[model samples]
Target: MPSHGAWLKVGGAMARVIHVFRHPDRFVSGTVGEPGERTFYLQASSESKQVSVTLEKQQLTVLSERLTSLLEEVASRFDTEVPPSAPEELTDTDPLDVPVEEEFRVGTMGLGWDAESSSVVIELLAITEGEVDENIVLDDTEEGPDAVRVFLSPAHARAFAERAERVINAGRKPCPLCDEPLDPEGHICPRQNGFLRDNPFTEG
Candidate 1:
């Protein structure tokens, strides 16, 4: 599907494009690949348009956590009615939509609450080789990098954050000793003085 966003042409060249999903039917974070080797993606889709952007696992985790904090802040500061958690009916367990073509790898992300609409706004900017101008982030200027902007309800945002937590935790189990991911075969544990523990979890 074609990406839905604003396109600016400067000097006969495309300067930037900003995809906006004002009322997306679905906006989610999903993965493609096995647990340890998975590629994380944030997808926003409306009736006929879908945009997917890749990001690191840690980025997704931080995004989810920050989103939750933002919601709490909005509630306490603005006296808004934010759901404590995602509603069960809104829980999305389905896989990502098909044709998972990546539009870009996310470099920086911006998030905020739209007081007028009471919606959570998420902006994902495409990675660039050079430094990003902070002012361009979450802005409508035509000179910034390509971006995807998704507006969602507070409940929907809660659901997205909860789902992200699940997707992140679905990765390989971590070794308790060193707090590093454990390989199925085995890994040398620093707690064991560079020795490979046959059963790392066992308290020998």
Candidate 2:
């Protein structure tokens, strides 16, 4: 467990500090604001600590897809049991226990498998001073920006992948004519020469 003071600070030249959560009770990806104006978040929590970080939709999508692919590869290569799918009730919801606030926006992310622990490691990095708050804490002995590190069991990783897939797909329906997402007020499809279609995506 990180000291309370350590949790309070995260800044510096751009160093990578690994804060590992071995088995978080809740690890989730969520969004705030409307679709176009949305802010994405990836949060993880144990009984004693919680961390939230800002991320982009593109990042979330890539993470989810990569996780799924990794799991498949691991299962096949090792002949291990496939990670179970997330429960249906849990797939389409945000499992945030605390209110959403960003610790820092993710600049770059890394992922790897820990063969010894049989867990997936996720590293959230703040690559530059500009990506971190100057007020964030840094030890006198420490240098560079801080990174948020998390480890997830295969089941939890699978759950996150499922939840992320649902969230990404829960946006506006696509217009068949132009393949552009339709707005609530409707979209003027370019393929239709800017014609306003109330329902261009009818079921076949």
Candidate 3:
């Protein structure tokens, strides 16, 4: 068991839980507090990208031991291993085009409490409506094969909504009515009222 002193303060914020985790990076597993405030840190020599778990004083004594064992189990499934700082073999490959990302539906919603900041973040919205605060909102819709609906964290979701006013300013000129690339010269869009389709895409 960890000692009572293992628990530490994160910041000045008197968050109810103790702290909160934000900007959930690709390199860390997310965790939050249950009842009391807790600290978080990286386990040395661990193969995980980064893991955030509560650090209570009581768990301090056995923290490394318990974490190591648990990390091993997780390592088997993901990339977790202790190896040389630099790999024996490394290579340089040609520049590949941008990777295409397929659209995926968020079938479920997840909630994680941040013990550091004492705030909560919501993820993966599936239900049309959840018993959450009015300050939070999530709405997703399936438009078509070429378009998708995205719900943001409200802090930064306004930059790219697929509304008419937004589309005009966005430089995303592909007509929704016509897959045909919008050309000011005159497009085949029925909505264009016979506007000419002028495309800069030239072929050799």
Clashes of each: 0, 6, 28
Q: What is the TM-score of each candidate against the true structure?
A: 0.83, 0.69, 0.18
Model 2 Cα RMSD, Å? 7.4
TM-score ranking, best first: 1, 2, 3
TM-score quality measure for candidate 2? 0.69
lDDT: the better of candidates 1 and 2: 1
Residue 168 CA displacement from its true place in model 1, Å: 0.3
- Where model 1 places Cα greater than 4 Å from the true spot, the runs are 1-4, 174-204
* Residue pairs that clash (backbone atoms under 3 angstroms), model 2: 9-137, 13-144, 14-144, 14-145, 15-144, 15-145
Q: Tell me the whole-model lDDT of each prediction, alpha carbons only.
A: 0.85, 0.69, 0.27
Off by over 4 Å in 3: 1-15, 21-58, 80-204
lDDT of 3 by residue, 1-204 (tens): 111111223365321111112332211111122212322221111222222222333333232234334333433554434222213222112121123121222233333332333323333322234453322322211211111112122121111111212222223356666765454444666667766656553211
Choose 2 or 3, whichever is better by TM-score: 2
Candidate 1 all-Cα RMSD? 5.9
Using lDDT as the yardstick, the better of models 1 and 3 is: 1
